[model samples]
Target chain A: MVLLEFSMSPLGKGESVSKYVSRSLDIIDKSGVDYRLNPMGTVLEGEWDEVMAVVKKCYMRMRKDCNRVSCSIKIDYRKGPKGRLSSKVSSVESQLKRKLKV
Target chain B: MVLLEFSMSPLGKGESVSKYVSRSLDIIDKSGVDYRLNPMGTVLEGEWDEVMAVVKKCYMRMRKDCNRVSCSIKIDYRKGPKGRLSSKVSSVESQLKRKLKV
Candidate 1:
């Protein structure tokens, strides 16, 4: 399984961007993928192709209206394991003996 | 200051991608931006334009040879303060009362 976390935004869209972010979230919600949104970015877990397709769709959606789009993605590809979205943090928290500020 | 963590790789380049990663790192290093390389991605701390320019350079370089390229970027834009690349982790470490496995 692969855990992909990404953030995409359009440049020159002014300081407030919740409108654009909301649009992207709508696409992600409709994709039916397991995802968790954090302050920095959204984490999605699934097959590589499915996950990437979602990102591609979101980028396309953003690109349609904006001239310059900026996207940042981070992928953690691991074999034989799934659900690293929470597990990874739990593992670290277990060592730290407390909950982390997510 | 903005803290940008990004990972870029060329798809269909087989498993080991140290060569491409090294090339991108060379560009980032030459850009003279303060950055730290971790297992997941590289965190760069600098002005928004400067940091993003480095990422653009890396993406363009990867696009030169590879037909398909994948990049993930997470950005934290804060009004004031620098050195978040280490200080962010250090803040958590301080609360955890120990060093983290960076």
Candidate 2:
């Protein structure tokens, strides 16, 4: 199983970055894995080297002090079955019968 | 402007997904948006809506035949600049005093 959506920021660092994206979401919530934080980016499952070692430790904690960093990664390697992050959006809202703003 | 990186896949489509991925790439190529495809995902640079529209089209394309689809997206919105796709990496390499594996 693999999901691994990612987003990193720090170019010039002036534009309200939510305090460096809350310090890389506090290092991906202490790297416990099985994450999902929407609004585009931050979804991790497991395996694939434990979600790429938690995205290389959130890009070495935003490359420490932020000189110019911008990371955007996306991976979706599937095998048999595992939680496809809310069952792949409930199978497209059960074929578009309703509910999708997730 | 924004940098969007996303990946989508059809579940149970039998492991090798290059065919589906190729289809999506074709769509992206035709959209005339600046993009870079990497091993992890495709990076697109454009206005937020422009990039997102491309992603939506890809999802719709995959949803046509695949019963279950999974999409992972990440966006980095920045102001006062553009062309972060290659520049971002070059900046890092410059600081590292060595080239990175792209």
Candidate 3:
């Protein structure tokens, strides 16, 4: 999974992030890709390349038309089935195995 | 001062925050408001109403045209000049005065 965030100077009027996000969604929809956008102003979940491509285009369009740009992206590995919950299993298992051996 | 952050679902393709930020700036500039948007995917500083109005409009547009929406808004009192410092200074002065009297 990848998480990306960006902030830039709102050129003349000094608007808000919500405005920018809405515009980008339109572009992504037109480009034909599967993704989910949350109301919290965050874009989450999608295939890597496709998502990146969409964001890049949107970022470019916004930047070209605005002044100053800043962005951040994070990608984390996702495990299958109980993906988030299982990471804890490893530590629990190790502790259990040690106790059993003792 | 007000600080606002919105993370939403990007409708069709999952995009990053940078894509959204660039777009807002343009609207702000055209609208004629004074504000600054930071690169950390945060919109900071601006006249109260203008910033809020722009964000609301932008947010609605994104939500109406997109799948989901989530946003966070924060308003803080900017201490003039910081005008006052919270730390060793005030206490130090008190201590010094006491010691001098002693």
Candidate maximizing DockQ: 1
Model 1 TM-score, all chains together: 0.54
lDDT of 1 by residue, A1-102 (tens): 998878788899886555676677778867998776544456788999999999999999998899988887877888867767667655544554554334
Clash pairs, candidate 1, are A72-B72, A72-B73, A73-B72, A73-B73, A74-B72
Q: Write down the DockQ of candidate 3.
A: 0.03
Q: Look at candidate 3 and tell me the lDDT of residue B61.
A: 61
Interface RMSD of 3: 23.4
Task: Write one digit per residue (lDDT tens) for candidate 3, span B2-102.
Answer: 43433233445464433443344444445554333321223434456756887776676666656765555544334333211122123333433321100
TM-score of chain B of 2: 0.95
- Ten-residue stretch with the least lDDT total in model 2 chain A: A93-102
Q: Any runs in candidate 2 off by more than 4 Å, and if so which?
A: A1-102
Better of 1 and 3 by TM-score: 1
Is candidate 1 or 2 superior in TM-score? 2
Q: After superposition, how far is residue A12 of candidate 1 from its true place, in Å?
A: 2.3
Model 2 pairs in collision: none
lDDT-better candidate, 1 vs 2: 1
Ranking by DockQ: 1, 2, 3
User: Taking the tens digit of each residue's C-alpha lDDT, what string does model 2 give over B21-86?
Assistant: 777777887799988654445778899889999999999999999999988776677786786776
